[model samples]
Target: MRVLAIIVLALIGSAGAEAREAQEGRADLKHEILKRLHDPNAARRRDALLMLGTFTDVPLSPILHSATDDPDPGVRAAAIMALGHASHASNAQELIPTLLRALKDSHPLVRRAAAGVLGRVRDPRAVRALQEAARDRDAAVRAAAVEALGEQGDQAALTTLLERLRDKDPFVRRQAARAIGRLRAPTALAALLERLVREEDVDVKRAIAWALGEIGNPHAAETLRTLSRSTDPYLSATAREALKRLISDATARSRRR
Candidate 1:
């Protein structure tokens, strides 16, 4: 009994010491970041924002929020991303407004970062802002916004996502197809089918096929069957796998019925 008590005490002491050391380390890191954030060099300030992203435990929201307005677009973008890392379910709603504003930043990089982070936060309030961003001039920004809208999982954004399927940028079109797949809206089947036939980009076609499979509507089976025989190995394999999922899902539904 004495030996067991001694072992428990030793462990408790060791854990206490480790916790104190971690706390001190976080304090030191916070100080360093705060000092660099005010430095004259924009690069240093940006690097500080990136470092701040790595430590979410520090009380750094005020500093990060202010950094979002930094003259340097790169620093502003980094600050937006750091805010995303600092956010959790409890505080995500509070951060949505900042991200929404960033989504409209003049710099495409800042807008793209905001869209990406808004998606990660997955707040319903951001849906409208993200929808607008989906029409951004920059293809990358549009793609990121489309992806974020899918992440929001609000069916209300489905119309916007479907429209993006016809975006001139093949990458945006691919992202739109993927976002639609994530939503798994059966109503999107016809649009996806139409896009699949017209899409010249193999990657976009593959995404359409994957979306069809994800929707799991039996109506898509015929199209998937044709795609399953494509000479392109990745598309063919994806189609075959999608067919399997459709079969599995349909079988499960029938059993439940």
Candidate 2:
């Protein structure tokens, strides 16, 4: 019994010592990153922000928060991305204000990054800002904002996403279709079907088909069946898959009744 107790004590001591060493190592890394963030070179500061972003286990929000104001737009964008990486559900809401401000940054790249991160944060408070960003002049920013609003899953942003389905940019339209699918709102069915009929972009058509499948509306079954006969193998396959989902969902609903 005495020997067993001594062995247990030794193990506990070893574990405690290892934990302390890891904590010290993390502290050292944090100090080095902080020092580099202040470097005169913008690239160096951006690099530090990138590195800090990967330190998800560390509570470095203060440093990342300040970096968002860096003079270099690239650095500011990187800081916003880093903040997204470091944030989790518990602390995400705390940073929504900072992200909202970045969403309005004069630099398109910075605004794009902010919109993308706001999606990761998934705060309802950002839904309105993201909806506004969906109208950004830059196509890339608009695409990012549309994607973010989809991530928000708020029904309030549904109208904006539906409007983006007709955006001049095919990429934004594709993203809008996918976002509508993510929402899985039956109300979006008619819009998705309408766009699918008029969409010349094969990629956008495929996204619309996928959205129809995700919504699993029986009304879409006839369209999906006709689409399944299309010459484009990819589109036909997507439509066939959507039909399967509609059938499966119908079965589920019947069983529930």
Candidate 3:
């Protein structure tokens, strides 16, 4: 009897309408974006957020805040991006902090998405949060944070950026080294030089060589000279070019002094 009941249940579930409704509802979803902004159903709320971000009809900041704290992480991630996608310059001040909070979400995707949105914010207040997120467990989030720090372009971030140069993930290290290059801080010369000597990752070595040239300090000249002798042709060529620029820049600075 039990075997017969199980067979009957399997046949009933095989009928297609329920499966079709779920798939079709997701595909044909065109709910009134604003009316469903605070809908009780999780699916409706998520759909509303997607619409609010993709469409320009909604300018709902209150709905954005509620979504930011939604029990569903996917909903919260969408809400964070929606704030930036819909907001103009006037609302950047309010949106930056919320975006920073999203970086600390338990969900890796949320943190990664928040990191990307924060980079576009251009708010100085976001620098500290971006720096902290450079240590995020997710490589994508760490890379995004490094890129965001570059967007800030503040010399104050130099120390934090130097620390990331040693990140276990070569991608994160490369991104950090690239951001350091964008800063053009002379103080970064020592760190960049050390990384050039110690870093085994070829891409990271190349980025360090570029950052040394960008920093343009005479202190980096000898490091560049040493790297120019490397067996790796690419590193040798980059080092030669960087040495020329650093020497030229140092000569120019000495003339001015």
For 163-229, candidate 3 gives per-residue lDDT tens digits of 9998989998898988998999877777777776688898889888888888887878887888899
Candidate 2: regions farther than 4 A off: 1-20, 56-59, 122-124
Instruction: Give every collision pair in model 2.
Output: none
Better of 1 and 3 by lDDT: 1
| True lDDT of residue 116, candidate 3 | 77
Regarding lDDT, does 1 or 2 come out ahead? Answer: 2
Residue 245 in candidate 1, Cα distance off native in Å: 0.7
Clash-forming residue pairs, model 3 = none
Cα RMSDs, all models: 1.9, 2.4, 13.5
Worst 10 residues of 3 by lDDT: 26-35
Per-prediction TM-score to the true structure, in the order listed:
0.92, 0.88, 0.69
By TM-score, the better pick of 2 and 3 is 2
Rank by TM-score, descending? 1, 2, 3
